[model samples]
Target: MIPLQRISVSTRTQTLLTRWTKHVQDTGATTKAARAQWKKAKAPKAKVRTALESMARGAVRCMYCDDNRATDIDHFEPLDEAPLRAFVWLNHLLACSYCNSNVKRSQYPVDADGACLLVDPTAEDPADHLELLLKSGRYTAVSGSAKGEETIRVFALNRPDLVKGRMDAFSRACSNMRDWHQLCQEADPEADRVAQALLDSPFIDVVHAMTRLKPSVAAVVVGPRTVPALDAWRSAHGF
Candidate 1:
């Protein structure tokens, strides 16, 4: 999964959150209250969704799988588990229904020291924990990091469909980069369109993985001709 950057909520939303959280903290049915407030707090939810959509990568994709379009505001720390953080912006992330509701519903794994074993893409780089094999579109934990392993298991990051999606995305990237390069070679202004096409493609982490691949390795997978275009796009975007 690609890393995500968190953004701010509006002042009114922030104030609403503070009020809701304080009430929850003071309530007898804290989790219930949080849930109730979440349903009632329409304005805050809409603004949070907007902020997350802007911060989201590749057409507002899920922060966990980065494959499906994000539609749910997931509690990074599940509301049931951490009621106090229910309205906290920092504890929120955009996710797809499959990942948020079906796979990772309130599943928060932790180590013996109480450290989070699940990798939060917003808090830390997922690549540090998980090494994505570009060709196979499978994720293997870097040095078998527990966090990476858990994240994969929890989200089914290497599920067959997901793997195939990633592999297909890589293939598309290679073809797209070649087109982008052709436009750039001719100094065509429309190269921007191809660049945007690359961005619009699903499973965008493939571009990042290819860019970071060793020159000799990348030559074999993404091809020697496509490398320059990928690099140029990456540089132009300041990624």
Candidate 2:
């Protein structure tokens, strides 16, 4: 999962959420009971979904896997588990059907000490807790963070199809970066255009990591194992 900026929603929507939350709190209902009420009410209509989609960078990809187009809004704090939080705007994330329905449907695991273990991409940087293997496109848990492990398990981030998808994205991004490097060598006017294009590429984070002079968390996750041409370009340009 990539770090995402929280987008602003209109005051009208915020007011609605604030009012609903007060109503839920006034009833003194347990989270489970509040969820039951929500199910019957069918709240968070189209407007809420639209705001969430905008938060997912126009719903270009799932916030969890970052491998497929996001098609649904997932409750970061599952409704049944934390019903008062159900309609809260900050608790929403955009997800693909496979990640939301097939894999992570309402499965909220907690650590032995009872802390929620899943990563919330909006609240934290995933690279701080997870590592990506370039060759296999699998995620590994960073020490001391249960967030990374549980997220991978619940979301099936290492499933074969997802691994293949990541590998393809990585390869394509690297190829583009290589082209950008060659153009830079001749001081070509087109070099800036290629650089901008890299920002728009799928899995563009890998290229961002490659171009930095210092080792970044993203670079450590995918590298220290070098692609020779890409490494040479990074060394020359990043310095």
Candidate 3:
């Protein structure tokens, strides 16, 4: 998983959240009341919605699958068991619905010694424990540890459809890279234009996959020395 940047909420949303939090803390209100308070405290609703959007900026792709559309707020620990952490921003994550539903909801982490097996995309790099098998498009555990196994199991990285999708994405990306290289070798002055054309191509999944294989290529083509922008572009476009 890629690193994420925490976005700050607007002043109005912050004030509303603070008041709602206080109400929850002081009165030990029902979940319905808490939600209602959060909703009713703000006017226009757009400010709160914008604040939620801000909170989602720079989050990594889903831990499980590749349906990277708009992300929903997810609880690291289930709200029913960890009620105090329900509204805690630190325990919240921006995730795709597919992953949130298919593999990860309410799945509490296992403890092995002092280690936790579940992958926390916000806190750790997934590449450290997970590696993509190019042939099968499945994620495998390079490290022989419970954490690695747990991560794969929880994410369903070996699922057939997911593997096929990743492979297809990787294949398309390779083709694009070859085409771009051919364009670059043409000795034309419009090399940058050609690069931009590749960026605007519909097959961004391939672009994202190629970047994972050759970061330098992405640096040259995308021209932004940052990973977040590339990731965001990939997710936003369903690449």
Candidate 4:
């Protein structure tokens, strides 16, 4: 999981959200009412659009699967059951609509400790609990706990199509890097020219995989000296 840079909400958006939250708090509004307020306030649409654009900018990739086209707002906690958190900025995330609706539905934390399993793209590193199966392109929880298992199952990380997509992205990224390296090997090719070529053709997965493999590649190609800087680029834009 990459640390997401929290974009400050515009004053107008913040005002709308605050008013909507107050309405919910005062009236104990039904979910539909809350949703209507969100729509009327025009905060949700803007927030959703901003979140999607942020995901596209960085290789934030999907939490469930590595698909790059995340276009919906996902609640780390189910908004229906945990309505109090609905407007929480940190709880909001960009998701592919399919993963948010089909697999995640109303599934939420079962107990205080059970909450640990939910992936927080902005807080936790996904690599800690989850690993990609190179052969099958599936995701599995290395830590065998209820939260981990439930998270994996709920997100459908093992979906064949999603796995294939991740693998395909990884393969393309590797191939690009290999090609770049081969080009560099050519007799005294211009370093500035090579760097410019990489900068021009930005592939999210390829850049991320390259960083993981060799920080020097990042330093040479992207000029990030620390992990935080690398993460900043990844969270803001994936490739």
User: Best lDDT goes to which candidate?
Assistant: 1
Off by over 4 Å in 2: 22-44, 57-59, 184-198, 204-239
The list of candidate 1 runs beyond 4 A from truth reads none
In Å, residue 192's CA in model 1 sits off its true spot by 0.5
RMSD of 1: 1.5
TM-score of each: 0.94, 0.76, 0.65, 0.70
Q: Which lDDT tens digits does candidate 2 get at residues 1-239?
A: 66777787789988877777776787775776666556654455465777766666322678888767888778877876887886788888888999999999999999789888898878887777777766566778888767888888999988998788778867776676667667877789897787666554555444533454244453554444434446655655441
After superposing candidate 4, which stretches have Cα over 4 Å from the reference? 1-3, 8-12, 55-63, 112-116, 184-239
> Per-prediction count of colliding residue pairs?
0, 0, 2, 8
lDDT of 4 by residue, 1-239 (tens): 23344566667766666666777676576666566555575655676567545644334455445464576777677657666556666677777778888887767757575544676656765556665544345667766655556667877777777667656655554444445455545644663354444433422333444455354445554333334444443443343
Model 3 bad stretches (over 4 Å): 8-15, 27-64, 112-115, 186-239
Quantify all predictions' global Cα lDDT against the true fold: 0.85, 0.71, 0.55, 0.57
RMSD of 3: 7.3
Q: Can you rank all candidates by lDDT, best first?
A: 1, 2, 4, 3
Q: Which residue pairs of candidate 1 clash?
A: none
Candidate 4 pairs with clashing backbones: 1-126, 57-237, 58-236, 58-237, 58-238, 59-237, 59-238, 204-239
Question: Tens digits of per-residue lDDT for model 1 on 1-239?
Answer: 87777777778888977887887777754678788778887877887888889998878888888889999999988988888888898988999999999999989999999888888888888889998898899999989599989999999999998999999999888888878778888999998988887786778888778777876687787777777877776677534
Question: Clashes in candidate 2: how many?
Answer: 0
1 or 2, greater by TM-score: 1
List the candidates ranked by TM-score, beginning with the highest.
1, 2, 4, 3
